[model samples]
Target chain A: MLAIETKQLSKSFWKNKVVDNIDLQVEKGEILGFLGRNGAGKSTFINMLTGIIQPSSGSYALLGVQGPNDSIKKKIGVMPDYSSLYGSMTAINHLHYLADVSGKPVSRQHCMEVLKLVGLEEHANKKAGKFSFGMKKKLAIAQAIIHDPQLIFLDEPTSGLDAESVIHIHLLIQQLHQQGKTIFMTSHNLDEVEKICSRIAIMKDGRIKKSGTMDELRAYYQSTITVTIKHSPIRPADLSTMQQWLEQAGTQLDIKENHFTIQVESEQKIAEIIRALGTYKIDIYRVDVEEPSLEEIFLEE
Target chain B: MLAICKREFIQSFKGIKSIIIIAIFLLTAYYSADFSDLLLSLSDDFTSEEKQIIHTVGISFLIMFLGMLFVMGLSHDIVNREMHERTIRFLVTRTSRTSIIVGKFLGIALFWFVCLLTSFVIISIFVHRFDLITLFQSASLAIYYSAFTVLLSVLIPKPSITMFLSIVIGIAFPILNGWVSLTSNVWVSWLKYLFPFYYVEEQNYSFLVVLLLAGVMVGIALLVFRRREC
Candidate 1:
């Protein structure tokens, strides 16, 4: 079964159409990254799917359940972007209370374990108000996963975190993904999205402009691959001969000192270039191929 | 529902605001009890039996007004604080909005009930007699005001505005009661019913009436809150 499906899903605030008609779907066990610019209705769309706000039009279903089913809430978890932990409650107490409300069988031991997983076991007795920003975010994650949900929505899970905290959250996401839990994440961190997301959908003006894997998106854009070659030291006359040979083959190349950077359409083209160079009796040092970065592809669209 | 109620009840007492409010209420109740005795002594127009009812009525008025003042202070921010702080999003996603409204109302009602009981015990010691009817009346009045304040908390966007508006309306209606009585017009006379204290007046006290009013206010709050977005 699909983890989430929406058909013409739309939400509006009075005359302002925050999220226009949108059709989206996510397969089970897939880590789908949702990306959009500010004021592009990402939060509104998530809110509608989570049942925090009713859609003005269209429909959506989560895990085969339709429209804010209470029984299905147990199977889904959410870490909202702007949520605040209770100031006076300790971390353990907060988790325990949330676990009970979310229909989980909460125990002090279990709560401590969840806190430990978030690197907050030692601070279990500390009030949430005393926690730092990174700690509060960890608490939010712990609350989201306390029920061991089949699916989780993490809105900006690594936003505003230090490098270490970001790495910790990324590791946690990897662990959850390895356990076969589906994750729907929204983030401005393209680098992290590229690292963890199996599929991605980019939204613009309340509409998805593109959705696919990184390779698929690159293929759709028909971006060229960059091939870097390090060749043995050669005389200036040898470089001229090599440039004429490349012109005869109609290959695009840029030479800088001892290295050559070639833009090729395919691996076959790269092999052809190497074979052509080999015929010139030029000794080769090494070759490295680079694919287009997600950031580049994202900005291109 | 029980989980939400339990959380709210426990959290209500965890803050210094609750302690401060309780202290202020206790001090006010103690002073009012002694003030009633002194006022009754100056009024020789009443016999000893009438003096007891008069003194009891004086304290009852104190409870009705002071209890509402406490409600306005304590409950104005109950719902809006969660919204302003963005914590309601957590509860709304996991539980029904109706449960949040009802649970929070019950929790605050519980807090106000305990405060009313403590105030009653202190006043009883100074008055030298336990007036069961007065205690019940004051307690119900306190609960009713709390319910109204809860409803207002859901309606208003800010706590300070809710408190200001509630106090203005609370004081305005009673002062308008005289204007409402001077006119013989049926509609104007009916305006007297608008005052929250009208139901808690000397001859108008009834446990059932107070409960019904509180229930209606809470029911309306639930319906309104269920439709509100986080």
Candidate 2:
């Protein structure tokens, strides 16, 4: 079963559409990274799927359950913002409370185990209000996964976090994913998502403009690859010769004295260009090929 | 639902809200036992038997009118405060919105029940009588006001606005209801029925009707809260 499926999902406030016609699908165990610029309706869309707000129109289903209820909610966990925690409640108390609220009363040992996974076991007795920002975030994560849900929606799971907290959360997420839990995450940290997620979706102005694997999105955006060459300084004569040979390739070569950057359509083209350059007898130090990154894909116009 | 109810019930006493309510109820019960003698000597509105009713459980009657105002103070922010703080999102995701409304209402009602039972027990010990009728009356009035405040909080999800209005309704409703009940003019007399004192003032067990009013308010609160954007 798909973890989540939405059809023409939209929400409006005073007729101002925020999440507009967002049709999204997530397969059962793959992490789908949701990326967007600010005000891209990412949070609003997640809110609708989590049942925090009813969609102004359209429909959605989670884990084969249509619409939201205790059953769907019991299976899906939403990582809430740190501000949503009650100040007076301790970390352990929050876990027990949220677990019971979901109609799954976990054992004390289980609650502590989740807390330990989030690196908050020592602070279990501390009030949430007394926690630092990073600690509060971990607490939020602990609460979200207290019931060991099948699907987890982590909205900005590591934003505003310290480096260590970010890594901890990422590892926890990876651990969850390894355990066959499907994760839908939104983050400003593109590198983290690129490193962790198996699939990605980019949203803008309430619409998803792109959705695919890294290679798939890169192919959709641009097939060009960057090849960096550490070669001996090129004479103006060699530069002209290279440009003329590349004219038929429909691209230009960038030469910065000893090093140069070239865009090629395919690995075959790179190999052809390498042989062409070697024929000139120029001493090439090394070559590095770089694929398009998630950042570049997200910034695609 | 029961989990949410239990949390709210325990959390209610974690702050000064429940403490203030309990102290007020207990202090009034302590003073009403003595002050009834002084008031009974000066009052002419009641028969000798009517004076006896006041003497035994005047604290319940007093709370029936004014305790609701205190209840407004206690639960006026229960629903909207969560929305204002963005905590309702955490709740609605875990449980149904109806569970939030009904659970919180049940929690606050439990507090009132405990407070009233303790105070009435004190009154009964002092006067050597347990007024089950007046206890129910006081409880019904509390339920009416608590449910109304929860409904109001859901209607106006802004805490600052509801806090202002709760105090206004708390003070104004009782005074207006009391005045309207005293005035026999047919046109304005119906206005007294709009408040709790009208039912409370009647000897025909009308306070039980306040429970019906509370139930309706809770039903409406559930509907309003279910559609609200968390």
Candidate 3:
């Protein structure tokens, strides 16, 4: 079953459409990465879905409940792009307060578990205002899932974290997904999204340009292998010889700075190029082949 | 609702804004020796009639200041803090908007009630030496004024504006009642019944009637606030 579904959801601020008509869906137990640049309406779309801001038009449902429904609110969790916490309360107090307000029977044990999950057990007694930016972000996440919500909306969860913290958060998200939680998150870090998300939706200007499973998206935008070869004492004749070899093998080649980057349509041609270069006794210092990354696909679009 | 209320109560004290207001109130009330002495001297010169007027005016001013502070605190607590901290989105998942509005109103009301009660106890100790009847009258008036002020806090979006309007209404209504009594104007006499301050003059009405009136104002405030966006 679909955990979340939106049909032509749109939102406007002062008559300027921030989120245009956009249809989106996430299957149960799926980690869907919403990729977009800054000011690309990624946060706006998440806000609309969570009912922080009502949509201008269209409809959406969470865990089978419709929009503006109080019951549905209980089934979801949201970590906003910015920190929203009571500064005077300690980190543990903040989580407990949210857990209580969530109308669930929460205990000291539960609060401890959540703090541990966020790696904030030591800082739990400290006031939230004294926490660093990264710690505050973690506290926000801890509050979001304190109710054990079935569905979660996380907006740029790893934007400002150090590398170690980023990895820790990613692992926590993975653990949640393993426990059958449905997550919908947005991020500009394509590497992180590509590493963890089962499906991705690329958005631009309040519209989704493409969306599908990673494999499906990769298949849609065919992967090209760029083979960079480093050679010494290269001359114009050597470049001509490389071009002829590439042309014969039906590959496209570009050369600059005594190096040739050959674009191979398929991986099968990679072996053919190696064999041809071996026959010519050309001094091949190194050969590097790179597949098309999500960054490359986004940039190409 | 209880859970939401508890959260609000605990979170309220954590805010620096609330602490500053309480600090100001305590400093002004405890250190203003001249004002306290003036109140004592005025009570001595005045007969029961003038004492009643002075007590009403004094308690009304105190309640108005408390009311304004409470209203501003609650408004900033409910609207400004959420937006400034960017926590509204996280809160939406745990509770409905109605719950938030109602919980915040009640939480702030409870806070004001405690503050007013403490002030009333202090004032009572001072006035008890003057006349036992005047002390009772002052306590009763404080209770009534606090209730009205809390109602205004819930209804108004801005604390300062609500404080101003509530003070004007509280003072003007009683003066208007005195004017109508002297002029013998039929229209004015009939309209005086509409003001709550008029009811405070004689204190002859049944306790049930006062309670009923307070309930009605609070109910109206809740109805209007529950429907408000954000």
Residue A100's C-alpha lDDT in candidate 2?
A: 93
List A-chain TM-scores for all predictions. 0.88, 0.93, 0.87
Model 2 Cα shift for residue A168 (angstroms): 1.1
Q: Evaluate residue A222 in candidate 2 and report its C-alpha lDDT on the 0 to 100 scale.
A: 58
* Higher-ranked by lDDT: 1 or 2: 2
Q: Go through the candidates in order and give the clash count of each.
A: 0, 0, 0
- Full ranking by lDDT: 2, 1, 3
Docking class of 1: medium
- The digit string of per-residue lDDT tens for model 3 on B16-103 reads 7768755654544443322655775854676666554453344445543353344443343354346445665556657776676556
Docking class of 2: medium
Off by over 4 Å in 1: A14-16, A230-259, A271-285, B11-17, B20-59, B119-136, B173-185, B200-207
Model 2 lDDT per residue over A93-174, tens place: 8899889988889998999999999999999999988998888888888889999999999999898788988888889999
**lDDT per residue, candidate 1, B1-230, as tens digits?**
67888776776676576788778767766876778768777767876655665535544665554556656666677898888888888788777787788888888788777776787688788877776666677777777877888899899878678868767756653456556645689867886554445555554455658778888999999888878888
The C-alpha lDDT values of all candidates are 0.80, 0.83, 0.70
Query: How would the docking of model 3 be graded?
Result: acceptable
Tens-digit lDDT track of model 3 for A38-80 = 8889998987887777888999988877786878777788898
For model 3, the stretches where C-alpha displacement exceeds 4 angstroms are: A227-252, A255-260, A264-288, B10-61, B64-66, B69-77, B115-230
TM-score order, best first, reads 2, 1, 3
TM-score (chain B only), all candidates: 0.80, 0.89, 0.52
